[model samples]
Target chain A: MAKVSKEELLHIANLADLNIKEDEIDNYLKNLQDILNFANIVNNANTDGLGETIGENDQCNVFRKDEVKEFKDNELLLANAKEQERNMFKIPKVIQ
Target chain B: MDITNLTVHELQEKLAKQELTSEEIVQAYVNRINAKEKDVKAFVTTLCDEALKEAKEIDEKRKNGEKLSSLAGIPIGIKDNMCTKGVKTTCSSRMLENFVAPYNATVVEKLNEENLIDLGKLNMDEFAMGASTEYSYFKKTCNPWNLKTVPGGSSGGSAAAVAANLVPWALGSDTGGSIRQPSSFCGVVGLKPTYGLVSRYGLVAFASSLDQIGPITKDVRDSAMLLNIIAGHDERDTTSYNMQKKDYTKTLNGNVKGLKIGIPKEYFGEGINEEVKAKLEEAIETYKKLGAEVEEFSLDIAQYALATYYIIACAEASSNLGRFDGIRYGYRTENYTNLKELYKNSRSEGFGPEVKRRIILGTYVLSSGYYDAYYKKAQQVRTLVKKEFDKAFEKYDVLLTPTSPTVAFEMGTRSENPLEMYLADICTVSVNIAGLPGISIPCGVNGDNMPIGMQLIGNKFEEEKILNAAYTFEQEYKFREKYQPEFKG
Candidate 1:
């Protein structure tokens, strides 16, 4: 069984960019540990001489014409934005 | 005939004969929804006015003697995961509670092109994550057969709505058995098309590789009808197959004589309820009577499927859901001092516990140190599972299994334990992992009278074979007559 420590849990949360509250970490730790332990069964399976399957279908490298099509409606695109300026999404400032 | 009770084909027949106008049909369904919404709780948004207006237009076209498609004017429900332009496609999460789609999903557009009346957005697990609707941020959908039991999810509402006769048919997306399990629990027919058989453009992503939109309906033929309309290529979805268009309805010839069927012992093993297993056995016997060759087979890699599914699905989910960072769409935190806090607090506050847990688990598997051990290894195992199915398909036209290990349990029965909750998907996830077409048809009922579903899995692009096999069984057995929900409305 894979044991997940508190520090590792917090580090994972950080990597996923999720904010875990201090008290909630323990619950997350226990649940994640349980899931990981269950998921560890894959390690025992013999995967030798097997290829990875990233997708199910055989079709690949499908390309469309390089012509640009107009969406023509920026208002609709920006409709769900929390804040917008001049039809563009407004976000917290970066690059101090 | 009651407008709400008519199948897609029956309703289309009536519409063509002008026995009932589209407005009248839409009103009847709305009335049913209004009466049963309190009990079934199947919809997140009901488009009553919009549907009525569209129904009137169809009626106008019918009066002019304009040619109409088979699905024209039939009311159907859309699972909340599929985007409908200007309608709230919440995926049953607080994160997208107020978010309205700017565009229609490809399937929604196809439905619109057929002039099908849209009833509403059906309830589902938040981002199609859980086996039961209990994980939904909205109200849990109750099984129409018995209110005490849960409707299987994350397409719970899709199956429940059809079972309650709220809609004759509804769309559902299956990733790890969301469509089939829920349909099994709710006593309806659900079909998950082979991955890329149906376009996934504009579907709210939850484990993209596994997710394929399908139909949940009262019977197998209605599933075939809906599949005919939605199964096609779209350049918008890069993964969408470029195969020639198929009329899935043509496959329902109801001939399964000499069809090869493999019964996977792993699916019928221990954890399955005795009654459910008996029902499946009886179904197998019925298949033999229909002249289909049935043989017991072993899928050795079956035990490893759940672990592989969770790792791959959650890992993909973590990457896909990263788009919900309070920037472009969905919920944004009210108070955040910086961009980092904006991403973190919004996701933490917006998403429910199950969604967060999956995200965390997904992140862990895909993280630097564990990537090769968990995520990559799961993919390799996925290849093995697919290969096993491929080998089985060489001898069999379709693989048969119980859709769920047990019939629908009481609400909150497995919610406390995440592992127990995932076990409900034991029989259905491997199909998604292998990206094969599978269907769940109600075979019989358990002791508690809840429905038990038997699954028919086919090779890739072999939906026709499974559909015909299910059609044959449905014709001979008449499972629908055994248990009918008494709709008080």
Candidate 2:
């Protein structure tokens, strides 16, 4: 089993897009190490020929008719938006 | 009369015969919520005025000689994770704390079609992540059995609400024993239906493949009734199975004679509390007395289930929760200077620590250089886990186990140790892993006076068998009536 160093924990947190604070990194590393260790138990299970289960059922490529429909509740949809302008979500500047 | 104590079936009979009005039933539950909610902290929001208005509308329809479903005028609560259009579905997280849903969850829509009065949104572990409501960004829901102890979660508020009689029933989603564990802790009935039995269109995703919504009720019959209304396929949810419709209530004939029951011996091993194990043994004896054939069997994959469950569920969660990136609805951080910082800051400020931990772990396992070792290995073991259930089901009709290793522990005891908290879900996580239907019914109470729940697991879509077996045991044991919680407000 590999120990999750503080650097690794921060790297993982960065990939997950979570801002791990300087003070909170140690706590997270400790907890993450414990959890990863627990999760390592699966490495011992003998599953050589088994295929992975993506879901419970056998359905694949489930599609619906590509027809346009009108939704009359644009305001309701945008009601929770942090900022809205002309029925579109207003976000911070993207693309420098 | 204490109308709040009556089950949904009894209340339905009264409503049908004009002995009670839907408005009166709504008022009764609202009054109970008003009196007891402060202590229990079950609801994130209560729709008292709205519920009364809907109840009155139902009464008017009934007086006009219009036919209605049996669930019409019945009061129910929804877990905060399920969308209810025009109502805030917060998932007890600050991330979506003020986000009003644009559409109703499919289950909520089905309940609306039945004209069932939705009392409000019940609290849960934030993003349905934790084993206790202590992790909720909103208020922590306490066990009705004891104020200091936790109501097992992430469906804590749903179970606590029903156990406290705040509502006759409530909807709860289970990924890893979220429904059944809390139901066990609070001495209520919680069912995690077969994964595809119910549609997940409007439910806020935690783990798409494993998450399923079911009922939390005061008794087994109410569970069946709620399942009947909510279980069906929808085109919106591709995973929803096209099952032949059956009235779940019709199977509650209380006859389990010659039923084949298996007790997974591994579930009763070390770490199971003595009182809880004793109660399970007593429940097995009850099934035997009812002429059900009970025997012990080995489900060896049980030990690895928790590990596999955490890996898969978190991996799915990390990807699913990626949608809350501050561009759309949900919380936004004012501390960011650019888009990338915006994403990180908003999530860090929004989600709780446990949610962050899972997200980080998920990202790590699914990240490059680790996917094959961690994530893929867990999936392969998942196949092995499902095969074990399939092998067990070939010989036995249903499997019995303790819903949790221990009764509700005092709050703050396990929350500090995240691993210890995760261990609480050991007995319940495997059911979600295998995509099977599992129900937790009150077996008896422990010496601490906290409730002990016995889990009855069925093969995929074989809910009726477990329901029949549970009904027979419910009729004979009558555990709820004998050990009612006294919440003196």
What DockQ results do all the predictions give, each relative to the true complex? 0.85, 0.85
User: For each of the candidates, what fraction of the native contacts does it recover?
Assistant: 0.85, 0.82
Give the top-scoring candidate (lDDT): 2
Give stretches of model 1 more than 4 Å off. Answer: B486-489
Clashing residue pairs, backbone N/CA/C < 3 A, model 2: none
Give me the overall lDDT of model 1.
0.90
Worst 10 residues of 1 chain B by lDDT: B480-489
Candidate 2 local Cα displacement, residue B299, angstroms: 0.7
Total residue pair clashes for candidate 1: 0
Model 1 over residues B1-489: C-alpha lDDT tens digits?
A: 677877778888887787888999999998988889899898999999899999999888878888888568888999999999888989999999999888899999999989898999999989999988888887899888888788999899999999999988999999999999999998899999999999999999999899999999999888998998999999999999989998887878878889999998978887888999999999999999888999998886666999999999999999999999988999999978999999999999899999999999999999888999999999999999988998999999999999999888888888888888988999999999999999999998877678899999999999999999999899988887778865322
